[model samples]
Target: MATVIISALLFVFVLFACRSAWKRQRNGCCGNDIQRLKKVKIKGDKCRDYPYRSLLHIDGMTCQNCARKIENGLCSIEGVCATVRLDQKEALVRMKRPLPESLLCGAVAKAGYTVLKVDFLPQSGHRSL
Candidate 1:
């Protein structure tokens, strides 16, 4: 009787695990069924307004929702505007002022993603007319 009960419990556990895996595959690793996320608009619309720019290579972004989450996280910072490219697994981040690398990494990390690298781009010479 004890062996039978143990086997049944193990079978139920396996069933639950299989169901969870199916959900992840169907709804993405983030488990969000929503296809699109609400766009996060930055204060400055023009590229010239942001003098500083950086590229972040991120990992663990499985879908558009993950990209949007990372973008939202970085854009939440003051003076920061971020656009994530899900296919490339990178983000182009622009800021009005220079921010520390730690801050940028922290933002991505907050969204359950890992920042593998950060490359600072040369300052843009374009000025607002």
Candidate 2:
């Protein structure tokens, strides 16, 4: 009886832990930061400050490789750092400026894709962390 009770308690603990991990993953899973180099090719004194992390919604990416290409492509753009996550088919960008809608959408289009939409998220003073 004691053995069965201990086993059941362990199982319950594992179930709880799994649920917590699942919730965290839903928030943002398997994301890596893209760090830009310290210099830019543009003429002297014509540069933007370091980028800020921002999240955006991108549509039209279909697979893992497609997502990777999107990340690389977006990162290649001047003044932007991007991490593309395929699970949710979304691109999270850290950008020096609020990207022009045409700029981002057009790149994806040139890559033989289309951007269905983009949503901007503003920073808030509160973080539960």
> By lDDT, who's the top model here?
1
Candidate 2 has which clashing residue pairs, if any? Answer: none
Per-residue lDDT of candidate 2, residues 1-129 (tens digit): 999999999999999999877865553332222232222233222222333445546666655546765766676677776666777777766566677867776666665566665766554232311
TM-score, candidate 1, is: 0.86
Q: Tell me the lDDT of model 1 at 99.
A: 100
State the lDDT at 101 in candidate 1. 99
Which regions of candidate 1 are displaced past 4 Å? 44-48, 125-129
The lDDT values for all models are 0.89, 0.59
Q: After superposition, how far is residue 61 of candidate 2 from its true place, in Å?
A: 2.6
